[model samples]
Each structure stands twice: as structure tokens, then as C-alpha cells.
Target: MRLGWYSDLNKQEKRTYWACFGGFTLDSMDSTIYALMMPVLMTVLALSKSDAGLLGSVSLIGSAIGGWGAGMLADRYGRIKVMQATVLWVATFTCMAGFCNGFWSFLPVRFLQGIGYGGEAVVGAVLISEAIKPALRGRVAASVQSGYAVGYAISLTVMPVVFAFLPEDIAWRAFFAIGLLPALLIWFIRRLVPESEAFQQVSKQSRKIDLRVIFGGEHRRITLISTILASGIFGAAYIMITWLPTYMRTVLNLPIASTSGYLAVNIIGSLIGPFVYGLISDYISRGRAFMLFLICQTLVVSVYMFAPVNMTVVLALGLLLGGFQGGLASGLPLAFSELYPTQIRANGAGFCTSFGRGFGSIMPAAVGFASTEMSLPVAMGIFAVSSYLIAFIAAMCLPNATGVDLSDHPASVVNEPSPTEAALKKTPAVFR
Candidate 1:
């Protein structure tokens, strides 16, 4: 099966896969670096827990807007063009964030940076899903999503050295400065990856992006269900991610070095989770695989939070939790993409994922508030358990769209011309 899948991909398709993988890797590193810096930033900026959570929430809000806007644009323009732009936009804003002098200054920079971060994910997922054949879609998309773990690992490994060597004030800034590295990916994408053929085929026939397309038609239920699904998954994920570093250092009284060591084990599990999820998803079905992982996530997170605090025990549970979370996430884009046809796939998938970020963004702040009443772990566990349960229900409600083809338009037709597309058509033939 592996050989068949590998042999089926042409040179262009293979390049597209690697491009999406690389783009997502850099995007994950740039975005997740903030989580690592949060503990330090809190001290340096005199930020209350609420303030820290607000920053995260605001950035996620920006991601939602960016995701929604980018998805619409990807439908009107081409995916590759919008994707390249998002990469540059995020890298530039992230570098600006490195220079911010205070809380107010950093807020806008991070928010702007999040726009590109959000858009890149949408375009990359849509591009790859459209480019590959349906039979390989589950495994390939999951593999691409695995880049998040790789990026997280890269940040986890580098952060310690950067912090240890540099002064505290400069160390945090330096981490943000490293966001500039992903700007180089634009050059790689420009040269290596082609636009999705699926998009190209439907380009002339495509209707302009309208809210009615996804939200007012037969697609509305799927859209609503998808958003709820994304929200639950994202909420649970953000709670763990936004607070894990702080929880380790503050509540557990772990030193910086020890925190890094524990996170390293978790990252290892994260790296392995996607492949396991991919195989399971390919063999069974996407929704079933997601449901299975969500169950594991609920269990592992409880153990990680409440179990005895021995170093070995913590490491083992952390690894398991990471695996469960990572595997659960791997199914999201596949399920979303499989549900929508090519014409609106970008919009549908992007909105669902981005909207999830918007809803999930609240958990960090909620956790911050809840921590004052109870221990951080208990607070996180409460939210996580609820979120996972909601996500499980949503997963069950969704259709089992494991290997559905997305290369064609939907059966229904509404080919209204977009202002954006009309403007694009006005460009000279040479420019086009």
C-alpha cells in the first residue's frame, strides 16, 4: 500500500507535498514559539495571567479573520499566490514583534503575524488535499500535518540554548526574531510548487466566494457541524498548549531545564503520533480514527494531570498525552477537506479550522481565570474533558468521508462572478 501510494505521486505532486510540509513546519515553529516565551514574557512585561491569555486570544482572533479572508481569496485567486503572500506577511509581522518595546506594541505585531500564520495553514491544506489522489489522501494529509510536531520539536530544542546564552530580555526577543527564517520558504514555494490542478480546472467555472455558498445552502449543516468539531478540538488543544509550560514551571516548580526535558519527551511522542493516526485513518475511517484518538486524549490528559508527579511517570504520561493529541489533530483537515468539493473546499475547511481557533482561544483566558480558584491542572482538566466530549459528539455526527474525491465541483451550481475574479481578469495576458 505504501509502495502504491508513493509510486502514484508524480514529480509535481511530490513537490507539492514537500512544499506544504515545509510551509506548515515553519508556520508551526513561528506560531508556537510564543507559547515557549509566554512564561518569560509574563515576568518581563509584568503581565497578569489575564493579560497573557488576552494576547493569545487576540492572536487567535486575528487567525480567524485571516483564515476566513484567505480562504475566500484562495477561491477567487489561485491557492499558490495567496499562500506565498501569507508566508511573507507572517514572517514580516513576526520579525516586527521581536522589536516591540511593551505589551501594547507586541499585541498588534503578534496579531498581524497570526494572520499569515492562519492563512498559510488553510492554503497549504487545501492545496495538498486537492493535488493528491483520494486513496492516499488520509495518509498524505496526516503526514503533512505531522510537520507541526517537527516544528514544535525544533522550537523546543532551540529555545533552551537561546535562553541560556542570551540575557533574559534579549532572549525572548531573539526567539521572535527567528520567525524571519520562514520568509525564505516563500522563495522555495515560488520555485518548487505549482498551483493545484483541481483549482485550475474549476477556476473559470468557479463562483465568487459568498457566505451563502457555505452557510446558506445544503452545505450549511456540514459547515455548522465542522465549526463545532473544530472548536472542541482546538479548545482542548489550546488549553494544554497555552498553559503546559507555565504549569510545569510554576505549579510543579520545575526548573527551566527540567521543563525542557519533559517537553522533549512529549515532542517525541507528538512526532510519532501522526503516522500512527494516518495508518489507522486509512485502514478504518477518518471519523472513527478521530473518535478513537479523542477517547485516548481524554484519558491520557487526565493521567498526565492527576497522576503521581514522579519524573519518570510525568515523562511517560506526557508522551502518551502528546501522542493522543497529535493523532487526534491529524484527522481534522482530512475530514473537512473530504466533506467539501474543490470549489469551496478552501473556504469550508479554512472557516471551520479558523473558527475553531476563535472559539478555542477563550480556553487560555478561561484557564487563567480558573487557575485562581483551583490548581492549574485541575482547571485545564475540566475544560479539556468537556471539550473532548463535545468533540467526540461532533466527530460522531460527521459523515465518514475517509477517501472521498475532491477534484470536481459539487453537483449544485451557482457561478456568480466575483469582484475579485473580475479584477484579476483585467490584468494583461502576460501578467496572467
Candidate 2:
């Protein structure tokens, strides 16, 4: 019954794959719930566009912190435990967000909620990357992100139904309450997922919480480049993802059917994109795949933003916009893991994706502030094209790391300090 990449995976790998797939699906759902509700929140809470954008930006910031912290914790404690904890944390905080009355009150809850959101994706991607074979890694890891589109569809499908049955205020709250349901998956994870064999093979005594490992030597160059790469990747995608719903409804004055058509098409494209991108990357090169997607995305976004708005234009280009951009969302986790050794794999990968969000976290607010002057499409075009251009350049800079063997990574890199670090350690702790 198994076909394609699924045919290649054994039972243990399949188990890990499904576990990560479920976690990521929920993570995507919780993240989209905020975006879906931004318009409702604005009407009920008297929030300005900037305020709504701030809420989006803050959660990304929280996710940034959570991701980096989780990676470090995963390296020290264990991936499964930290992943379980993060899922529980996100579910709890997200439900609490439903109770808040204003932006100020919602701020802390949303931010706390984001921490879990960010941690889960980074850890899940890292976990899957560690568990799967190099030959199947791109196809498998990238396919997992298709769950994002699935999550978006779930939110889109459920939101209207919830709103149809309940009062506006109650519907949003009920939707938020639904967030807690992901917590139920933690039981399955605990029972089914085992610690990564790679982690077990490595000596526990050698592990420590040193931050410098990811920032020094061979890691330093890749970390800096990958962070910028991730920033570009996330910045490009999230800028549109965060604000598109609001733009369609508020700026375009889109009738409900038209808006839904565009979003539905876009979502479908996003669902299909990761698989195609993964197949392309596996056969060609990861760097080439990114370069191709980023270039095409820039052109597609440019057209999507600048071209005159009509049902025809929107319908024709909507799929390309979502497919081109959304597919690239997988690039960071798929590509970045090969850049580091096992010990700091999560730490490095986590920081790149998380802090990439940290860097990317700037745009929603920027678009919100810009909405005061320019058209949303204009603002989106300017920033989105810019983001893609940055990503294209980063893609150019990245080493071709496709189908790299993960099992062969040596532990010597983590234990060894670079020349600069060696000199600094010998000096006094404070004065040096």
C-alpha cells in the first residue's frame, strides 16, 4: 500500500514521521487561528491594524525565544520530552488567550502561546530530520509542512461553522477552546515516540549547555548565513500569511465568495507545494530548489500585488502565489540541519528558524504601519518582493547540502572549541 517515499520508511521511521506530522499540524492550526480571528478581534476589541499586526509580531517573537530555548533544551534533556512540554504549553496559553478582553491583556497570553508554537516546529523538523534517511529526508521533511495548508484549511472550514452557530464573541472563544484539544496528542507521543537513536548513540556525559558551539568554527558561517536565509524565507512567507486575510476583507472590500475563492485556491496550492518542492529538491539540489522557488515567488508576488485586482486576475494567480511562497516554507528545516553536527543540530537549526522568525517578526508591524499610507497590495508588493530578493541571495550563498547523510555526523565538532573561543576561555570569566 505504501508508495513513493513512504515505501522507503520502516515502522520506527513511520512512527516518528506520523508523530511529527501530528504535532506540526496542530502547531499550524494554532498559529492560523490568530490570523483568522484578526478581523473579528479588530471589530470587537477596537484594535487598529497596527494593533492587530503587533499581536501577530509578538507571537512570532515569543516563538523565536521558545524555539531557541527548546533547541538547547532538546540537546540537553531530550527531544520527545521538550516537544511534549511545548505542545502542552502552547495549548494552555492559546486557550487562555480566548478569555482576554483587550490587546494589553491578550499580549502576554499570545506571546506565551507563541513560544510553544515556535518550539514545536523547530523540534519536530529537527526530530524528523534526525530520524529519517538522507535519501528520503527532503521528501519526508518537506511533506510534513504540507500539514500547514491542511491546518489553514481546518481553521478556515471550522471558523465559519463556529461563527454560524455561536455569537461572535462566543465563537472566537470556542475556537480558542478548541486549541486545548491538541494537548490530547501528547499522550500518543509519550506512548509511541522513542528517543532518537542518534541521541542515544552519543555519550550523555559529553553534552553541556554551552552556547558557543553553534556560533563558532564551521557552525559560525552556516549559522549566520542560515539565519539570514531563514529570515528571508520566513519574512517573505509570513508577511503575506499574517496579513492577507485582513487585506482581502478590509482593503479589497472583497465580497465573501470572492475572498473565499482566493483563499481556498491559495490554500490548495499551499497543500500541494511542499510535495512538489520536496521532490524537486531531492532530485536536483536544495539550493537550486530554493533559488528557483524564490525567483518565481518574487515574480508571482509582484504580479499578485501590483496587477489590477479582478476576480479573473486573483483566481488565475492565487494558486501560484500560495504555491510558490508556501512551498519555500520548508526550506529552512530541510536545508539547515545538514549545516551542523548532531550535538548542536537542534540548537543551530532552531536558532536559524526561530531567530529567522525574530528577524521576520518585523514585517507584519511594518505592513500595518504602512497601511496608513500605501495600498495593502503596494505595501505587500514592496516588502514581499524585497523579502524574496533577500531570500534569493541567501539561497545563492547556501552550500548545496541535498541528500546529506545525517548518521555520519561526528561528535568532535561540539567538544572542540575554536581558536577564538579557546583564547577567551583561558582569560578571566568577566574581564575577558
Candidate 3:
């Protein structure tokens, strides 16, 4: 197959990719500030560990709702509109979070921010998948998705510098207000991005949202397997990203600077992980690439959890864990896109991924609750091992997409209704 040159992408696809990437990167930056500032916030607000955990859980729940709703909206209104709306929503709320006077105010603001964050990922993934060529799609999507890690790295670098100069009370709020910067990207998106061609073709065929179809026949098996796989992977990811810094600080007894340094190293590994997996998935089978990463993740997470707490050992383990986990972001978009047809691609990916995200949200809180009773290392180890089991199940159940042409599948298999069936059945419910 002839690979299209980057220059060959019509202006619209290029614009869509960059806009989606920028939005997602900013979304990561906004969401990560809270994790980076968790310790400071806990002390400043005089909140308990459980309370801190609640804040994170509530945000995840909000994101779950946002992603679900945004997926449907993207299907109905077009990806560009949903993408623009979500970026504005998250940016405004994230800035508001910085100004909150207390827990009550912060909770609601963060919840709203979560909605924006959730919508960004779903919209971004769908936009990129639709715009890029099939052969290059995995790598391009992974590159766009890697913006999250880039944003995360920026937050880690900026936060300490800002805190060093300003008082904690003022500095933290300032960090959050920085989220507003992404809203500026909306102008670029408005100028450049086009409605996805795939989305446009599907929309002309059907405007209804029939979510129940996801559970009928062959799709039911794929849906269940995808949900379980996504839940386990995301659960592990959320726990790792949200609480690992605190774990480094409290459990390993590292200073703030040292913990940040370790996290920086870990994130570098994360930045590399996706690109590597994207390459492998392009040349090899997507399932094979995912399986390889899943095995590595299982091993890395176990070692990171149970290893003796020396600084060098911990840093090494953290790097490996970040790399393995990072590969999932690359694999998931390609895997899920291939699983369903173009019509319902956003909905299928959003529902399975966000729902899994919702289930995974429980892990961080569970880890926090377990920390009150058991050792942090033991609690983390349990979460790590559980993912291995989930990976095994996914490996067994997910279909191979090595030679599949997405366009050949009935759009309803993804999200579009068959023209013939339009006369016979009512539209499906949009599962937001």
C-alpha cells in the first residue's frame, strides 16, 4: 500500500489533528495540576486523605458523564463543535477551581472540570482517527494522544517553580487559572478543523442514537471484553498518575523536589512508550503489540509495588511502569477504532473507555482506603496484579484487526444505521 505523504493530508485533516492534539494536551495540563498540588492542597485545606481521594473520584465521575455525553454529541452535531465546546467548558471550570475558598466549592468546580477533561479525550481520539490515513492512523493518533504526557510534564516542571516564588495559597490558584490558556486554542480550531468525513457520511445515513445495539449479537461479546480491558487498564493508570507522587512522598519518604525529579524521569519513559507502541502496531499486529505491553505492564507494576523502597530502585521501577502504562493510550485508540465501524466509533470508544474509566476511578479511592489499614505497598500490589488478569482476558477475547477495512463494515456495527434498517426500526438511545 502506498503511504500518503504528510503534505498529502488536505488542510482540514491537518487542522483537525493539531487542534485535537492541542486540546488534549491542555486538558492533561489542567487535570494534572491537581495531582501535583495534592499534598499542598491537603495541608492548606486541612483535609483528610479520604477527602483528597473523594476529590479525585468525583472528578472521574464527572469525566465519565462528560465523555459519554460528548461522544453522543460528537455523533449528532459533529466532532468539531463538541471538541470546541468541551475545551471551553474545561478551561473555564479549571480556572474557577483555582479560586475555590473551600472543599465544597472546589469539589463542584473540579467535577465540572472533569466533564471537560473527559470530553476532550473522546473527541480528540475520534477526530484524529477520522482524519488520518489508515496505515498512519495509529502513529498519528498516538502522537496526538501523547500531548497528555507532554502537558503532564509541563505541569510537573512549572508547578514547583511557581510554588517556590509565590505563597502556597496564591500559587496553587494561579496554577489552576493557567488552564484558561487552552481556551485560546479554540480560535485555531474554529479556523482550521473540519467535520470528520467519516462522521459526515455516517450522519447523513442516520441521526438517531441506538445504544442498545451495542449489546446485541456479536457486538455484545466485544463490548463486554473491551469494557473489562479498559476498566482494568484505566484503573491502574488513574491510581498510578493521581497517587504515585504522594506515594513517593509519604511511603518512600522522599522530599518534594526528589519526588518531582523521579516523576519527571518516569514521565520521560511515558513519552517514549506510546510512540514505540504506535510503530510496532503499524508494522506488526495491534493485538500482538498490546499483548506485549500488557505483559510488560504486569511485570513492571508488580515490581514497582513490591520492590524494596530505595531511591534508585524506585526510580527505575517508576520509569518502567510509566512506559508500560503509556503504551495503552496508543493501543486503545487503534484497537477500539477497529473494533467498531465509522458510524459509532466515537460512541463505542467513548462508552467502553469512559465506562472503564468510571470503574477504574474506584482504584485510587480503594488504595487510599486500604492505606488506612494495610501498607501502601501491599495495597498497590493488589491493584497491580489485578490488571494482569484483565489483560489476559482481553488478549483472549478481542478480535484481530490486522487486515480489516473499517469502511467495509456496516456503519451501525460502529454507530451508523443501515439505510434498509432505517425503515424498520427506531433509532437507538444515545448512551451519555
TM-score of each: 0.92, 0.94, 0.90
lDDT, candidate 2, equals: 0.82
Poorest 10 consecutive residues of model 2 by lDDT? 423-432
Per-residue lDDT of candidate 2, residues 246-337 (tens digit): 88898778854566667888898888888889889898777778988998888888888887767788876878878877679876786877
lDDT per residue (tens digit) for residues 1-432 in model 1: 467566788888899988888888888888888889899988988887877887887888788888878988998798889888898888788778788877898789878887888898888888888888878887788888888888898888889899889999999899888988877955576567888877777746555777667775456777787888888988998888889999999988998888988888887787788878888888877767888899999988887777666778888988887788787776777677776766777888889988987888888889988888998899999999899999888877676556756654433244442222332344333222
By lDDT, the better pick of 1 and 3 is 1
How high a TM-score does candidate 1 get?
0.92
- What TM-score, to 2 decimals, does candidate 3 have? 0.90
Cα lDDT over the full model 1: 0.80
Any residue pairs clashing in model 2, and if so which?
Answer: none
Winning candidate number (TM-score): 2
